[model samples]
Target: TFRVVGHFNTGKALVKATCGRTFNSESDAQTFLDACASAGHVVSSIETKPSTKKPAAPFTTSTLQQEASRKLSFSVSRTMGVAQRLYEAGRITYMRTDSTNLSDVALKAAEKEISKTFGAAYAFTRTYASKSKGAQEAHEAIRPTDLSASSIDASREEQRLYDLIYKRTLASQMADAKLDKTVAKISVSGRDEEFVARGEVITFEGFLKLYLEGTDDEDGQDETTKDMLPAMTEGQPMTRQTVVATQRFSKHPPRYTEASLVKRLEELGIGRPSTYASTIDVMQKRGYVVKEDRDGTPRDYRVLTLSGTAVQAETATENAGQERGKLFPTDIGLVVNDFLLEHFQNILDYNFTADVEGEFDVIARGQLDWRAMLKRFYAPFKETVDTTMEHAERASGERILGVHPESGAQILCRIGRYGPMAQIGGPDDEEKQYASLLPGQSIETLTLEEALDLFKLPRTLGEMEGKKVTAAIGRFGPYVRYDGKFVSLKADEGDDPYTVTLERAVELIKAKIEADAKALIKVFEEDETVRVLNGRYGPYIKAGKLNAKIPKEEKPDDLTWERVQELIEEAKNRPKRGRRKKS
Candidate 1:
């Protein structure tokens, strides 16, 4: 026997249950259901309530990146870069700010702009308090320098981001939106289960007229919240519709995105507004985490009955063009995280990091001495580091798979200097071979079957002109080798080099050879013997150690000795490249 609890939103429902007694067999559940068949049940009560949705607070550094990612599909780095450029160009105010408090001047300008553009009814004179724990009150939230400047000469990306800032700033000062919330309760005829239905209708748009803040949900918002319920009374008669019983399994927590990670860091008070972008940048550069394009396929599917037959129909797939950017830990990342967790638990602990951040904040506020805080933290940290260096295990991430079937060699997965790699045989063995794992494949989850498949590489693809041609996976991807030349296989269109036929390999090799042979254009008739060649950067003339680009009007083949001499002379007088001095 079991007890069931349910919560509903409009037509949507979520059911939860707790087992009262163990059922060894299906007959036990059936016997309990038979006993409860004669019991009576009915709708007890239905209620309606009014709710209000306040306008979102002005965008902080973290919130801006989060919204830009959702609405503009911009990366954290890209958003910050564009914002920096905008700030320098006087198109916007300082972008690296945490406080949501608007300046009196900016607030007055916003009121005028909102009243003039959206009418006086849309404008509301209100102050938004910053909810961030340790936000810097001196700096205001991101906003435009001039509210009346509706257009700017900028790139498309800059214009899109500027518009988002403008709308959000204007909307932040708007009135709270009014909503009519309705909730219904229906009890089963024979069971004690009471199902609830909830819905909300927007009575007043208010700030929604200007903007609606984006959510972290992959599907954006709940559709049930927008749906209206049928006219229900206190004890209305209810009829049973088709029942759906779905079996679902719990899912692990989702991986973090750049936006979500920034949000988390801000929430934990781990970093300040100016450091969020740099922290994410350093992580990516060090290859601790990678921004991977993940498939955002939802789990919900609809059921349609046709001619007494039930058919499952899937909803339309979303995030088609807007591929979700998810951060995945690489093998090196996993190793580094594990090592830190084992040896430096205090440093890696969330609460410890947050507390340290609080100490920094105290120092900034002049409530605590900076040197004292450092002394308190550094002593134990140094001791721990010194002790851990002698006892920590090597973070090689090496594990043994079963032996190979044909060679009887032991297969091992390990993190090499470059990346995670699989090997057949050991260093002591005479015939040891190594292969890199494919992108997205990890050493931890790679199976023996997959490892064996890597050994089939470096496959011979017949001979060409008395030279052996072979296909192999290299550090830079798949390639075909012939004679002394290596030809890269184009796998962009789903072509696999492992299964590429000899004919295709020969074609690719020939194409590469032809391309390499076509680089030389002509030799100039000069004492310096300047040679003109077609290079990747375009046609250019090389004279000894110096090189000069050929003009578009003058082709490499059409260049005369006089033209070559003039180009070389011109290149000699050109300014040399140098590092820019800081202002």
Candidate 2:
């Protein structure tokens, strides 16, 4: 429900109700509307107050990562990596720290810098208290090593990170920003319902002048709070232009981004500053979660086009396909999460995790025995693991989707060794044919109709030049087969092998043949032939045995022979990975 202020029918300003008040039923609503029409309303009261926003504390590791993710679009790992480089170069203090307390030397430097840059009025000398329960007071928060060394020669990414740190450190020593808030209570002439409107304006910039804290939302300020309200006194009459009653439902919690997840982990005391980036990295590397592009729009409604007219209808389910970077749990991740909850409840418990973290802190402070703590935790955990290993059922991702209508066989969706797949026969049947689910289909939500649709695989697209041509889904993706020659289908174009026509299949096969014939990109002046070809992991250029990945910023066709040679050399000189020996 919303209320707006505007001109009324009469030249004299007056408050009026527009939409019918909500009730238990339509009849009740009508009765209320009739009552409101007979009655009247007036401005009851108004209040204006002053509010102030205090400056945020100096950067902790978690807060720093959160800010970088929100403002610079930097991943937590990337931010830490650049910060580590800066720390190593003596440009910043230790990056891995939870304490918000600043050293006397650092604070004095910040005071000098703030006073010199923004004048004495903007300087704030009060020290901030550490909010973290486990913060180490011995270590200071992240700050510049030398405030005067603002300009430094660094990489583009390092420069941005340095700038952020410098501004944030200075802003931490600034005054609070002042705001004026106004709220009005308007009574309808004949209605019992009262409408409330609120607005606020920033009266003093203060710390906001140097830096405004970033939020998870792209817009740092709330729309309602940012709006400026006109001056009004108590009992001043207000004209209601319109009253809108919108049927709004509660929204589902948003998916976690890197910043939000770090914040949550910190709140729960699940991990320390140093482990935050590694924890997220391990999740992605193990395929428990995948970073993918998603649509930013939370689709709460579906637009239907009928008879050339578009109508928007509210929906519970969101539509797929929005472009933004976010992390999503895979089927395996869900399975693992459920399995851990069932078998290792104590280990996976939030309180248990936090308690263990507290125990580690105790050990760090030399107040507890580390070995005793480990022994107490390990005994039950080992026993549970041993018992569950023998009894727990394997989550093979198998689900019976009911019997097939015509085949009389049961349709089953399961996660095979490769990935999620569906079959059309019983477990003992040797002749069961399996097919992978369509790109976006999920086993959890697979219906009988959708499962049966998978049986239409290895589709024959008719003969091409007297040779039989077929299209089907392979391990990689959709492909067309003609006379034993397999041609991969490109979705960037309007091609889907699942629904490709005979003519399209023939054309694709021809294109594949042409492409294969010219795999050699160029014969360089150094007698090196650089060939661009598809590899197990996307597309790359091959010079001898060294393969160079095509950078996202550079197109394959735009590469020159010299650039190819340089890329090949770069790939050849790349460092090899191996386990590090403990010192």
On lDDT, the leading prediction is 1
Error of 2 at 18 (Å): 12
- Write one digit per residue (lDDT tens) for candidate 2, span 431-461: 8879888776777888888888777878988
- The global C-alpha lDDT for each of the candidates, from Candidate 1 onward, is 0.75, 0.75
How many backbone collisions does model 1 have? 0
Residue-level error in angstroms, candidate 2, position 574: 16
List TM-scores for all candidates, in order: 0.80, 0.80
lDDT of the structure predicted as candidate 2: 0.75
Per-residue lDDT of candidate 1, residues 1-583 (tens digit):
2222222222343322222343343344334334333333234676777777777877788899999998998989999999999999998888888888888998999889888887888788777777666776668888889988866889999999999998898889887777887766666565554556666788877788888888887644452256566666666544433232222233466668898899999888788888898999989989889997866555442222111123232333233223458888889999889888888877888888778777877888899999998898899989998888887778878889889888888899989877899999975788888998887689989999998887788899899888999998877788889987778888895557679889898899888888866887897455635788788899998898899988888768888888888999999999999989999
